[model samples]
Target chain A: MNPIRKVLRAGFELIERPFDRLFGPALNPVAQLGALGFFFFWIVAVSGIYLFIFFDTGIERAYQSVEYISRDQWFHAGVMRSFHRYASDLMVVMVLVHLLREFAYDHYRGVRWFSWFTGLPIIWLLYVSGITGYWLVWDKLAQFVALVSSELLDWLPIFGEPIARNFIATGTLTSRFFSLMVFMHVAVPLFLLFIMWVHILRISRPKVNPPRMLALMSLAALLAVSIWKPALSQGPADLARVPNGIGLDWFYLPLYPLTELWGNGSVWAFLTAFSLMIALMPWLPPLRRARAAEVDLEHCNGCARCAEDCPYEAIKMVRRTDDLPFPTEAEVNPSLCVSCGICVGSCPSSTPFRRTEELKTGIDLPEYSLRQLRERVMDVASGLSGPGRVLVLACEHGGAAGRIGDTVVMPCVAMAPPSLIDFILSRDLADGVVVAGCAESACYNRLGVQWTEQRFAAERDPYLRARVPRERIATVWASALAASKAEAEIVEFAARVAAMPPKRLRSPLPVSSTVPTPKALQTERGTT
Target chain B: MKALRWIGQFVVIAALFAGVAALSDWPRYSQIPKDAGVVMLSFVHGADRKGECRRLTPEEIAKLPPNMRRVQDCPRGRRAVYVELDVDGRSAYRADLPPTGIAGDGPSRVYQRFVLPAGRHDVAVRMRDSARADGFDHESRKSVELMPDQMLVIDYRPENGSFIFR
Candidate 1:
């Protein structure tokens, strides 16, 4: 990672840890930025609709109507107006921070480019909708925004007649002007919502709403602030006079002041270049992607577990093309795949008990096959000499990758299935198996740690068998910079494993006949 | 202890909201000075055609295609418009605007604004839209009183045949 992003990521983690402890990891705002944005969007929309009910679109009445809402209906419409404005401000802050967080995590590259690319237009639409919303108040600030925005548009060569002419005098503006502003304020946000949908189209099970308690708490906070300091317009706009000092919403109108400082043309040029650079950020330096997963038809039983478990939604079930008895088979779209090897973990055929000369899963990464992973684990386990004789399956992106002994790093901790853990403990390969992945709710592959936790708890498919003792299994979630914490966790788990009673050895089975039967396959599928 | 943590989290969230509200409207922006007035010169006017029409000879007309003959031939392009404004005997704004459209056959548009002290001032504007180009075809001068923060607009209309000040 770049040094700047590394520092930023660390800073964010520092701030988030306390919140995680207070609100719990599931409800932390840092993990819920996207969902919180949606909550704010709904607040803005609902309050805007209520404000429009009492708003008049006439040029002369527009300012008076807003004043009435702020003064006459202070308790209801006034609070709603404040909610509309402050919620909008909050949304912008959340979105910008969200963008920075994703950039710092390097989530804008590879297959995740679609979300980042689609976000560029949302930024424009957000500003456009916000600027137009301010214009509807018809106050001094609105007049300034109208004239400056018009002047900015007039800077472009495409306009044959300068739009600034419309704001020259009091008689120049018409009722149609307010109507147009209202239309833009409403229409742009509706289009923005569509783009927001497209932003998460590639990810499976995107969270569109925050947790219930978090939402209620955020609402209460917004309400308290709305009542404490109500939003009031800066005075009515007088076209015959120039607008002097006025309150400015720094979130949306920050660029308006730039137009005056650095002439309109320079501002426009800067905006164009900056937007273009942000739009092409994913490929500013193209990524070198890992090889995608491939399917082995002979091992596949037409089970859709891999398709269901894929975080990228890159896999889908299709009609079986082979003579397999099952009705459907998994098909992988190579372009959308991140080659995280998560499908191998979800596949029922991915078990160390399979005794074939070459162990192949239904869908697996070509670079690091399941057979190689098993062999690597066995080799790492054989060299352990301590009393605990621990084997750690660590995620490459997390803190435990190289911090402890007898470690075998996988692309994601979930890439090692529960059956692999059972295989190790049952064969006396290691005294304990510790699965360490990225920080909670911050999985590099989105759901690697989540599914791994569920599978171990026997709540999800391909669960750990009851025979494997739970005391010998431990899991740790930490970021890449938390190496000391990971080491501490390993130390504690190793001590516990070392103190446990010795396991009863089972009769050794012939290696050539360990393939799963039909009934065993059904059990792996969680259908029996 | 957990309750205390929850209270602390709520206070932090409220503080964040208060911070956003504070910046939402603080540090008031002044777009224009209080004791200054603005004058904006804006107009959209088409210039004269670039080339004059010439009467075709009878022989030339006869050689033309049966349905494609005319008495005169004229070019489609128009001349660029030149405009200059002087405030209190100083050049304030000047532009040589090109005609609109790909064929250069449309109106030339311009909009410029200048800020001056709020007091009595003399304003003059000149525009040239013909091929002659050396001197202005239309000119106007006015002496007007401007109050603090007042706006004065200099506009033009083809039918009015001169500059219009409001």
Candidate 2:
């Protein structure tokens, strides 16, 4: 990772911890920026619909209709206008913060580039929707927006006739021009919604709405401010009189002022160059990812667990191409894979109890195979000499890397199957096994920690056996910057493991595990 | 204790939201200084063809095919347009706008704005669009009182007999 990105992620983690503690992970605003953007968009849409009910589109009646909403319908329609304005402003804030967050967290690189690239156009559509929205108000502020925006647009060679001519004087403006503004204010947002959908098209599951409680609280905040200060228009536009000082929505209109400072041509050039740079960011230095996971048809049972557990939806179940008895076989889409290795852990055939000379899983990463992982674990565990003799499986992107003598680094901690933990403890290779991964809900691979927790608790497939001592198995979740905290957790778990009574070691082959007793073989299925 | 923390977080978030929302309109922005006004000159007009039609010579007509024969031949290109503005006897703007299109046969477009002090001032605008380009074909001069933050627009319409000020 870049040093700048590391610092940014550390800063984001520091800011997120307090919010996470207060509101809980599900309701944290910093984590739910994309969802909050949707929430604000809906607020703006609903309120705009209500205001449109009383809005008149006529040239002479447009300003009066809005003024009437502000003065006569001060309580209902008036408040709705304020909601439309404030929520739109908040949407801009959320969109920008969401972009920065994704970039800082390194989510905009590799296979995730589709979402980031699509986001650039969504921004332009949003600004178009907002600027046209201001034009519909037909106030001095609207006039300023119209003239400045038109002049900025005219700088391009695409337009044969300058749109700025329409705003030369009151005589040049027409009712049809007002109609076009109204049409764009509505049409552009509908297109914006379409592009927003495309922004998340590649992800398996995307959060499009904030938590219910957070949404309600946001609504209340907007309403309180609406009552405190309603959105009112500036004096009606008079082309004969130049608009000097006016209240401006800094979120959308800040670019208009830039046109003045930098000149229209320079501003246009800057915007074009800036947008192109952002759009091409993903390929500026493409990510060097490990080889994608490959499927071993002989080991696969068509269970479909890997397909269901894959965070990127890169695995699929297809008809068996070989003479396998199962109806379906797992297939990997290499383009979409991030080489996380969660699929290997999810495979039922990934157990260490199989008396094979060389272990192989149904779906496994080529660079970091299950065989390499099992060998590393056994080697590290057998060398431990202390009383606790704990072996730690740590994620490279998370905490605990190089923190202990008995540690094995994997692409993700979830890559270690629960059966391997049981095998280590039962064979007396180590007195305890600890799996440490990225912080909860903040997994570098998105669902590693969640799946790992569930599998250990026996709530998910390929669960830990019932006979493994619960106290002997421990899990720690911490960010890469919190190495000390993870080390303390390891020490605490080791002490607990040391206090437990020791069990006789099961008979083991040098290259295989002994079979369990009948009672120990019985599975304990967790309630759904 | 958890409930108290929740309340504190919510209050802080709401306060920040309101603070930014207030900035949507508060702290007014001035686009231009109080004592200044703007003058905009904008229009689109096509100049006459660059060359006059000439009767075809006997040998030139004989070389043409029957369907392509014509009594006269004329150039398709149009002349470029030139414009100048004098505010209070000072040259404020001058430009020669070339015709648009691949063959240079389209209209020339212009949109320019300049700032001047708010007071009575003499303004002069001139344009030349014909073959004889040394002198102006159309001209307008006016002495008008401009209020602070007022905008005056200068436009052209041949049908309206030249410059129109608003």
Candidate 3:
């Protein structure tokens, strides 16, 4: 990570930690707020379809029909109307939260800029769809909206006459005008959905909706609100008279008040300038792209483990070119890879026991390959002399773990294979190993913390064997704000390991099973 | 126990929803009074006569396509109307109404509403068409009695050559 982003991330962590502790990880997965936005959009769509059936599109009947739905069909259609309005409002909230969260995480920089750029348009489309929906009701509030919107449109040079003329008199408004409003209300939402789909196009296995339990709770809350306070339309539009005032839904119509203060042209300028600034944020400071991962076909076993574990879907298993023993080999697509290197941990061939000419793995990052990792681990282990000499493996994004005196920092803790821990133990290089990473719900790489935990527990591939003492290992999930807690965890683990009897090593695993030394490989080949 | 905990979480969420619903203060129709008078002002202006084209010259006609040549090909620009209204000698409303369509060729229409006290009052209205800017092309001043909840309309009639109040 760049120095500026590192400082920015630390600042964000300082603010986020207290809130995380208050809300608990499961209840406050702020990282997944974008998925929650999608869930709310689905609710809005379903309820909107229900409301559409009862809507009248005639100029005279539009307001009357909405009133009938709210008053006469109070039980069903009325509740649906409330749901439609509230869910759409909530979608805006979720999108804003998601945008801020990404900015804080520095996820909008470099290769990730595509998602951020596409997201800006979604905000505009959502607002357009929402405003058109208000117009469809044709109430006094709708009349206000039409007047201001027309004034704003008239600010542009393209129109010959002021659009405000359409609503100047009751005789001028026609059913055809109402039809155009209905068409836009429906069309803009469809466009919004399409933009949302494109927003996730680069991500592999994108999580479009939040966890089912969370989704259920959110939906239930919305339903309760819908029943408790049904949505109602304002009095029928009276273009012949000026409206004194109208209730405003602050969530969607926050800028409407600005029109009165700033005038329509200035308000339009403010909104457009704000949107352009947000869209261009990625290039404001500029960031260097991380190196992509490389695949070693000779070592690949066609297990497709890397493909399965990749959060970005940058890796694929294809037919082997040479006469390798495996029929398929792993391949990395350079463009899509963020160089997270979690695939290195997923590959069984990444074991450090090998003594070949060069340490190699099936899939490895160019800057931080398995060979470099092995050397760093051995160097840290060899330097430890005193009792309770512990090696703490930490993720770069997981706090100030790398700043600790005796620690090996991986791009992500998940990028460190389980065998690496066993290798350290067998060599007696460290008295204990402590693994710390990002908070489980807030992994910057999405699945890093979970996959690391799973690998250690033997629930996923490249699992730690039973022989490795679980007692000597401790995993602490920490955010960047919890540096002190992580350090305390490491100290506590060292004490616990010092109390136990020295781990008696069973016979070392056979050479081939472990990472082979070059001489060992040569001798084995000669024997064969 | 897990299910019970889940239920408890949902109850908390429901309480939150109730709080927000209470605080929203959404408006309702029943709040508006039934007895309200509305004064409607609506009119379409006469066609503009200020910028009509002159008869084509021989040289101008000769430059046209063979099939398009004619004695005259005139262009008519729609009138721009200015309207002003006064209630009891206090200026209540004023606007410059442009032609309706994108090309400024459609009917010039104005629809506006003014809510006034339900009582007798003096009303004056004036309008200027495109052909003359020095004075109003039409004007009306009248004394009228308005009943409670009455709807008064002011319209323009080309055939009658006057403003009609109903």
Candidate 4:
């Protein structure tokens, strides 16, 4: 009995050690960011798989496949489409949040600067992925993306040269190379995983996933949203037509607003400055003497553990042959220091060449005022409508319902987030949200209103089925509604939403199947 | 109300542009609309280039020994086979070599073209016995992978066997 007990104990110790090392390592605020990032990646993968099965690449078959998926097999394909679109936005949001949190926390100095530096490319890739996804629809948006990309590239020196000539060589788009673009759109995410791994390597405690419950709920919500309102593909691109109002994604596309304020070249300059200025933040006015890292001379043991663990490789040891306590004294580089506190945590001997909190004494949130800002945002959302059960949209399309309780909120619906969406939905603040976009890719700013639609496409952008089922959220490309089109739509949409049974807020996670059982399949089909 | 009407007019004009886009996309719909019927249209792609559908130029006849040349088919008729040879003269892409009256996975699909007359007809793919005899075999080879649903055009001199009716 004693021997068996000892063996079981040994097995547990072996298992528990790894878990403890992973979870309870050094102090980490940035680990939460990693967890959220992984959560969104999972959403992206699940949605991509759903999208790929239905994506057709032929010139004639592309739009057709989208139509079949949205309208014909909408019950199943719709859910999958929603998952893909919603998860894409969710992942991007998580990534942005993670980057901002790290920046605010001052985790990008010294040895850790490499991770910070490499992260710029990761953000670029994410936007490109979003752009490619938009183009896959072969709608007006795809046409616009093509036009803009061509125009941008045309100004470069290579167009008449071999490189540009080969690229625009009339027949290549119709050749085997076109197939490669399809393959690449599917494969680029695999490369992004490596970039993320390196990004989180500086931290001792890195979370590769979110809490189990949140993951499952997010997946379920995505699936539910997809089912409620299947994604719709506009007809094939028409170069001749002009569309009215289009949806916009404001996060990455905030540049769109600038375009409205400025023309092409100046806007381009603004974007370039925006990225470069952030990159050049460390070179700003030097930190105050107190804010810079300083050594606690009394605790100095010269063990050099901090130097070993530093991610930016910023610490250097000076050799003094004749000095009393010297042979290997440590010095910290102020220019390279990110103040992430890896050195503070790694020191076995209680000697810190620089203090972590001291370096960040003057730190504050990037936003001007958290409390005042929150109140202002809430006010804006609330103030959009005149009264009860208001529908806030970016466009003025859906006011025809005039059902005493219904109203359209804003000029563009893409500005609202799932959180804002949740606040309104939970309080029964609005009866519904009807986002009618211009034809896909028709936004003048080259902003992805459709991409925004895709991101918030989930049944619960804030939380699945928290207030309304996914079906209540929709993306319709409105030219002008015929004489009575806007009125008919408003009345139609409001009545339909009002008619829906209250949403059941079950944990909005996708149900997974390790084994494909018959019962599981039936339950998956909404039988249970 | 008048200002509102003006804004509404602007929106409608934009919408009209969208409607025109929709209208143009109608015939290109993925699924045949309920109102669709057998419309007269050619399956126009790169059929002629893929098929051996080139006219023999007058200079070529003069270059050829006069005794070997015979009055062949019409100069402007579609041929049965198209051979696309690679730059190095190796066999590359071929079209219209399958047995007539059948369409399946093989060398080529059977011609159901209304433009081509229905019958057992002598056809020329890339090169035939006469073209070989006239030393015009160089024009018959093309290098490409045979794909499903490919279209091509072959040109033959003899108009009798060359008229396409599908």
Name the top TM-score candidate: 1
> Candidate 2 DockQ category?
medium
Error of 1 at A150 (Å): 1.4
Off by over 4 Å in 4: A1-31, A110-112, A161-180, A251-261, A286-528, B1-166
Tell me the tens digit of each residue's lDDT in model 2 across A323-384.
97889999999989999899999999998777676777788889888888876776666567
Q: In lDDT terms, which candidate is top?
A: 1
| lDDT tens per residue, model 3, A1-528 | 567556766766764565465445556535568888898899899998998899989887898889888999988898888888888877887788688778877778777788999999999999999889889899877887787788678777555545776664567788888899989988999999999999998787788878777788878888888887788887888765544357766666777767766877899899989999998999987666678998888788899999999988788888888887878888888877888889999999998877778889888988999888877776666556567888888898786465646788988898999999988887666779988898766787888887888898999998998888899999988877678888788788888988888889764665443454334444665899
Off by over 4 Å in 3: A1-29, A507-528, B1-4, B15-52, B57-63, B73-166
Candidate 3, residues B36-147, lDDT tens digits: the string is: 5556677766466447668899999999999999987656557778888888899988888877666677666676656776778788888887577578878998887765
lDDT of candidate 1?
A: 0.87
Instruction: Please provide TM-scores, in order, for all candidate models, with all chains considered together.
Output: 0.92, 0.91, 0.83, 0.39
Q: Model 3 - which docking category? A: incorrect
Worst 10 residues of 2 chain A by lDDT: A519-528
Give the C-alpha miss distance for residue B83 in model 1, angstroms: 2.5
- Decoy 4 TM-score against native: 0.39
Which sections of candidate 1 miss by over 4 Å?
Answer: A499-528, B1-3, B52-74
Write down the TM-score of model 4's second chain: 0.26
What are the root-mean-square deviations of the candidates from the true structure over C-alphas?
5.4, 5.5, 6.1, 26.8
As for candidate 2, its clashing pairs are: none
- Candidate ranking (DockQ, best to worst): 1, 2, 3, 4
